[model samples]
Target: MSEAVDWGLALATGVRTASSGPEMSMTEAAAEVAALREAAAAVVEPVAGITALSAPEAPPAVVVDRAEWIRSNAGALRTVLTPLTDGERQVGGFAQPVSSRLAGLQLGLALGWLSGKVLGQYEALPAESDGPQRLLLVAPNIVQAATVMGVDEHDFRLWVCMHEETHRVQFGAHPWLSEYFAGEVAALVRGLDVGPAELAARLASGIRNADSGGVAGWLQSPQMRSRMSGLMALMSLLEGHADWVMDQSEEVVPSAARLRVAFEQRRRGGGLFDAVLRRLLGLDAKLAQYREGAAFTRAVIDQVGLSGFNKVWSGPATLPLAGEINDSTAWVARVRSM
Candidate 1:
């Protein structure tokens, strides 16, 4: 897998003029990463309770510190999950490595972070790029991955490498992937024009009593319901496929299921104080929908089988709209007929 590669020194640099537009500058990416690191540290350091985790074989103090820093942030890390969202903010677990046993417990989160970051970055790729657009930010925990996954650092690195490389491969193979996803997201954002009465009413009601987490919450208005539906539909397919790819490989990794279940529980459990969602995205749109999306994808896989499920990803036009997920049998037949 170590083919021709760039150390990514210039990779994180600001987005120069690409076909899409000006990409985020490296400086901006760094600042963003720094801010997230601080956020991750803030969450983890407090959890440490002043006593460092006493491992039989801890690395040097600095390595441990870096590892702990990433771990602490693992539970609360947040930023763009997908390129569809601006800044593509998502939590940091995908970039950080935890113990392999712990890896399963956190799979949902890692997938959430990974799926969003990887796919979001893919979607954010500017028009006509030669390869995977440079990552504005990458979160990698050299020490954590080794300890958590019971794998060599290089192997763990390969895991992340695969995630990033998949973005490149998917986009390269199907150039329209990013555009289709981003367009749906932009549509949702555009649909989110709060009405004067609703905005005024929301203001009058005071922020504390807001339907902040509901579908009609601050970030997700009724108007944007269609956008939410469409975005979820798209996300379900993308993430479903990514998770399947990661889970299906028997040769490379054997414990993906354990990791996935653990991760799903964490995702379902919601954040401590439920602050992780609000602090990161200015919304809690993901907390509820992720499980639903997972189920939807699993249902598709079960009903259609891998080949049929994989076939769904052949093109953007074939993808199900928000309406099709609830009634997938109809679409399954439609897919089969076509």
Candidate 2:
């Protein structure tokens, strides 16, 4: 049998290079970090009398201690999900090759890459920008790296491993979400209307407010708030479902409850650190999404039972829409009325 290759580098390189042509150069592609940083700064600039959302709560324990968590749970996670993988213990989409997982990573990276693409295609980027055209995953969460760490650190490591693995699986299964998020961000970027004068004035105003609380002031804009809310909703939908799935399989995982409670506290606390980070990073605790999605799944299960809910996974079309998330009452009524 072939040796198991590390999935992390393959995943990252694939995602970073997915859109670039065979010979594409870093010089040819614009950077995304600087652009996103500018956008982040722009969104946080201060306007008069604007107060920030009460510093979104302390993010769950995940961000503060994730590096240690993922290393701990790696083996158990790999074992519990073994049924989904090939004989080599490499998991991929249903009936797909392990290498196909790289395709999934591409989807997540695409949304980040679009930031650079949009800035270059449109004249909206700040001058002197230099960023990579890919989404960056902090190393602690990357699979292959976490896998090699010592077993003694299993508790913290496994928690992060499962969380990231869930992310990878979702992206592999739901390619549409990647396309949708990218489209939304690109649309918003193209819709920018800040002229040079307004930009300068706002930057000046932001500088004055910067001393008050760094970049919290700019985020007070109604438009910025609205956009941030929408993205948070989407992130909730994604992360929530994964968290729920993890919960469902808790019995199979010894440390499940510990990790679950830890993560719950993060989102419930309004997410990690800086108020702007909570909002702009688009990371939500996903408790609401998990409740809604799980309820929807349960409604389907109650109506058709587990077999029927499983059918929903046959394809994306069967998945519930945003409205149907908690609307199990409708499903129950329909069943009874029949």
Candidate 3:
């Protein structure tokens, strides 16, 4: 595996980066898992009203701590990124022996800290599953968010589930989405022509000059952004759709606004260290996905209504182009012309 396997070190260090936090008792974790499952059931019909997709498979909800959450996801990340890593390995010597070790440390620390921010994830592994996919909820993070927001624990937990279950339905109903997303990811990784050392040095340079240029300055070059655009658009659509569905779930939580406020606040106030990690790790892009995507979704739904909006799910081709995400009218107009 060597230093070429930066993700391996990333897992080790990433978990370290995020606070594992105080462990929840087994009983507490189990109870939260059950509550999340219940929330999924309650939300299905209402969420269906928002989108054409349905939760056909009643996947089990998993409640895990920060360490376990990272552990479980690491295997999947490895599977997806291994090809790219191997490709980088071919361009050897450009990366120093210490470079891989340092990258590993950085990755691990980043993940460890990120554990607190992640509320839930839909881990897709159709090859391993005979029944249905798994919905992972980081128990500690959920607890932390609830406490931080001063909201009802159950209400907050359910709110998190709505977003995840919507994710499950989107991927589950549209198997093509899984393949398309993976293909995009693989293409990006395979296209990389540098080793960890060179990449890190560039990233360090990017960070230094990034302040003047802002996110555009150091985060991505023109080619990188073009390559990432389609993936970004897809992510925006999925996340924004989930956010829209969660909001449409008016009956699920009475104080949705406060819940939103709490999460928004949670993303901020990370201190200088946290800010650097977020930029280095590309988390800023992730946070922006929620805002941009939700806005696109809202604009489309307002213009087309739920039934009309279903056209997006009709096929991969119907999905919005990268530029359309920022301009809702363009997406709506494009869909209409089709």
Which one is best on lDDT? 3
Candidate 1 structure quality by residue, lDDT tens digits, 1-338? 11011112111111111112124476854554454334332322221221111112211111112222223223221211122122222222222223222322332233223322211122232322333233221333323333444554333333333333333444444556666755554454344443222222222222222234332353556556656655666654444444444444333434545555544443322211122222222333344444444466667778976566656657865787767766667668878887
The C-alpha stretches of model 1 lying farther than 4 A from their native spots are: 1-132, 135-155, 161-164, 194-224, 261-295
* Model 2 per-residue lDDT at 17: 46
RMSD of 2: 21.1
Which residue ranges in model 2 land beyond 4 Å of their true spot?
Answer: 1-153, 191-233, 267-321, 329-338
lDDT of each: 0.37, 0.34, 0.65
**TM-score head-to-head 1 vs 3, winner:** 3
> Mind giving the per-residue lDDT tens digits that candidate 3 earns over 204-224?
333333232223333345675
**How should the candidates be ordered by TM-score, best one leading?**
3, 1, 2
Cα shift from native, residue 231, model 2 (Å): 5.8
Measured with C-alpha atoms, the lDDT of residue 323 in candidate 2 is: 46
In model 3, the Cα lDDT at residue 198 comes to 46
The CA root-mean-square deviation of candidate 3, after full C-alpha superposition on the true structure, stands at 4.8
Q: What lDDT, from 0 to 1, does candidate 2 have?
A: 0.34
